[model samples]
Target chain A: MHSFESLSKDFAAFFQKSHFPDQPASLYQPADYFLGLGGKRVRPVCCLMGNELFDEILPDTWQVATAIELFHNFTLIHDDIMDKAPLRRGMATVHSRYGEPTALLAGDVMLVVAYDYLNKVRSEHFHRIIQLFNRTAREVCEGQQLDMNFEKSETVSLDAYIKMIELKTSVLLAASLKLGAILGGAGEGNLHHIYEFGRNLGIAFQVQDDYLDAFGDPDKFGKQVGGDIMANKKTFLLIKALESADPALKAELDALLQSNHPDKVEKVLAIFRACGVDEWAKTLKDQYLSAAFQHLDDIAVLSKRKEPLRSLANFLVQRDY
Target chain B: MHSFESLSKDFAAFFQKSHFPDQPASLYQPADYFLGLGGKRVRPVCCLMGNELFDEILPDTWQVATAIELFHNFTLIHDDIMDKAPLRRGMATVHSRYGEPTALLAGDVMLVVAYDYLNKVRSEHFHRIIQLFNRTAREVCEGQQLDMNFEKSETVSLDAYIKMIELKTSVLLAASLKLGAILGGAGEGNLHHIYEFGRNLGIAFQVQDDYLDAFGDPDKFGKQVGGDIMANKKTFLLIKALESADPALKAELDALLQSNHPDKVEKVLAIFRACGVDEWAKTLKDQYLSAAFQHLDDIAVLSKRKEPLRSLANFLVQRDY
Candidate 1:
């Protein structure tokens, strides 16, 4: 079994080749530029890992993995425009650098190219993979819409927020694994377990992300420790703190949300600490982590074969950054 | 053989069913609303007609038909956003009514739903249909980018403009026919002929559309004559006139393009007429129409089976609107 680092490198090397035609540089260059900006390539690697769990990885798995990465970048481009974000991955976003219209079209063509890759998969696995992809893609859009709605909403229940996170963030991870497993010739039972494992792992990672933003060392995390707090962005810690805070504490948190004070993040962190949200967040992350492992364990594969995924999950959730 | 009108009604009835779920109203509602504002369901109906030309229309044809319509609307929503178009089908465009972010997501989900419908097609036909759809979709995006690029360009060649029009408008119509014909068990030769027929017909219709905007009676056209002129939109007449105009006429046209004069449309039309572009446009339209019919005649089907398509092509290009 390949480790996450090794598989990520393989995926990266494979993906270094361009997926788009060079013409209409106005439209495609931005797409190429954004893909070049690069990330950990975690989702595509997850796909490879999923395939490896079942059998020696097939050629089709690489095609699907490319599709997942392209689809993920498509979402990021459009999401950046919608969010009016200026930077991503510590650089100018596609919209910021290339302008919104080009960025929008770039995102669109990336999606089309992603499907072009999917269509290249051998026909026996093509229909099921496309169907699962469609469902997951639609859910991701719905999740984005819900996330936007939550911003204007005065109150969002924890359950609703979690659902949004699942739709926006987790399902793609889950679907990536499932897509690879489908191509790997896994049976239905193993498919479900792998998907659940991915879904739960994604949630745990997100929780840990939120926890790091609030509490981790800034130098270690490589981001401002309270950037989410400063923006009044919704995250697990803030949502849970709202739900569990006393009336006085809730009022203070609300005021902090309304302020542009320099101390806002510090004050919010204090309220969160006062309400035990910090500890609660860790507990929530552990719960999801355990659920993830439980699902992973239930998969009908030799435990030794699962080591790569096991270590990957640990690396994802146990990180400070 | 189904007449375009009859098949249109059939498509309308089938499409009255919602393609999106209700939970995320912000995302799905704009999509639903945009689909509700009916245009002539030309592309989907073309799919059905293509099916009938080879054999009895199959249930798979309807599914592919739905996919075509959904995909077409998906483009319109995103295009409207990119163009900042306020109105569509005599109503507010999706972005104008629902806001850009929601509209963006709506378009995204609509595309995903389109694939969902396509995935419902039987596996034997699914792979071919998806490959064609992806290629056509990518060309459409490239065409849109080229159209936008032409807006800022000081000069656009007639040949380049025609290619852009083909990409932006003609290919989807062509692919719609090809998709249906594939499902109808069309042999490869007939598939090429039908696609070419649709392509040439689309170009002819677009030329006629530009002609009507410049010269047709507003009462018949149902749009203000010279609206494209007011927008300084590049059309066949304008581009061709620029290419063929003498130096003096060219200077006049250039001046008109820069001004927002109330008589700008009249001045541009006068230059177009002086260059004999009006007559040239008529000849050009006829050239494409004749080519379309030639391909239609070439299709290896009973001549009688070709009547509906031939008449529909006439109705499209010959109409003032």
Candidate 2:
């Protein structure tokens, strides 16, 4: 079985072929620019891992991986516009670099190109793969709408937030694995286990991401500590703090959220610590990680064949960053 | 053979079922709302007509028809946002009424739903249908981008404008017909003829639309006369006039385009008439309509089976409006 790192390199080499045409440079160039601003390529790698876990990876798996990556970037471009975000991965976002109109079109064409890639995949399960993709794509949009709704809302339940994260962040990851597995000729029973594995691993990774943003060493984490706190962005820690804090501490946390004080991050961190949110976040991450491992264990594959996915999951959630 | 009017009614009835879920009303509601604002279901009905031309309409044709309509509406929602159009079908555009962010998501989910519908079709040629849809979708995006680019450009050539219109308007219509024909067990040759028929018909219809906007009575046209001229929108007549007019007339047209004078429409109309653009538009429309009919005649189907499409084409381009 191929390791994540090896497969990632393979996917990168394969993806270097441009997905868009040269003309209408205004529409396609921004899409190319954003795709060029590479991330970890985790989702596409997850697709490859998903396939490898079931069987020798088929040629169609790479196409599915490429589709997943393109779809992810499409969401990011549109989400950045909706969020009015200026920067992504420390570079100007598509909307901020190109105009909003062009960015919107760019996101659109990326999605179209992603489907074109999917259409190129020749698999017995092509129809099912497409159905899962459509459902997941719709859910992601719903998740974005719900996230935007939460910004305007005064209160959001933990269940609601978790649902949003699953829809926004987890399902695509889960779907990627399932897509690959589908192409790999995985049986229905194995498909369920791998999908659950991805879903839980994704949630655990997100929890770790939130925890690191607030508390990890900035040098190690590769981001400014407590940046979410400074932005008054709601994360798992803040939500837990609000739910678990004593009345006085809750009032203080609310006040901190209202102000842009110089010490706001420090103050919020203190409150999070006081309410045991930082510790709770770690425990939550561990619980989801354990559930993920349980699902991975339940898969019908030999334990040896599952090693790459297991290692990748560990790397994703165990990282300080 | 189904008349366009009958097929249109069938499409409307079939489309009465809501395309989205109730949860996250923010995302789905705008999409539903946009679809509710009725326009002529031209493209979807064309699908039905195309199917009927080859054989009795199949069950899959309705699904393809639904997909085409949803895809068309998706483009309209996003285009309305890009154009900053406040009104559509005499009501607030999706972005203006629901907000840009929601509107963007709405358009996205509508597209996802469109794919979902397409996935429902049980066709032997399913893969080819998807490929066609994907190609057309990408071309439409490129077309929109080109249209936006032209708005900022100092001058746009007639060929460039025609290409834009073909991409933006004609291809979808052609694809709709082709999609239906594909499902109705059309041989390859008939598919080409029908697609070309739709393409030329679409161009002719657009020419008529441009002409009606400039010279038709407002009461008959159901829109303000010369609305395109007032907005300084580049159209076939405007481009043709500029190309054909003497230097003095071209200067007058240029100055009028630069200003929002109360009589700008009248002045431009005068220049257009002086340049014989009004008469020229009629000849151009006939040229395209004849080409469309020629292709229709080339289809292997009985000539009687071609009546509905021929009549629809004539109705589309020959109407005063």
Best by DockQ: 2
**True lDDT of residue B177, candidate 2:** 92
Q: Find the 10 residues in a row with the least total lDDT in model 2 chain B.
A: B312-321
Query: Which stretches of candidate 1 lie above 4 Å from their native place?
Result: A319-321, B319-321
Number of the top-ranking candidate, with lDDT as the measure: 1
TM-score of each: 0.98, 0.98
Task: Give the alpha carbon lDDT tens digit for every residue of A1-321 in model 1.
Answer: 889999988999999988999998899889999999989999999999999999999999999999999999999999999999999999999999988989998999899899998988984877899989988999999899999999999888999989999999999999999998888889999999999999999999889988999999988888889999998889999999999999999999999899999889889999999999998888889999899999999999999989999999998898333
Residue lDDT tens for model 1, B1-321: 879999999899999978999888778778889999988999999999988999899988899899889989999999999899999888999999989999998988888888888888984777899999999999999999999999999889999999999999999999999988998889999999999999999999889999989988989999999999998888999899888999999988988888999889888888888899888889999999999999999998899999999889988887323
TM-score of chain B of each: 0.98, 0.97
Q: Tens digits of per-residue lDDT for model 2 on B1-321? A: 878988888888999978899998888878889999988999999999888988899998899899999999999999999999999999999999999999999999899899998888878888899999999999999999999998998888999999999999999999999998998889999999999998998898889999999998788899998889988888999889878889998988888888999888889998999999998998898899889989999999899998998888877788333
TM-score of chain A of each: 0.98, 0.98
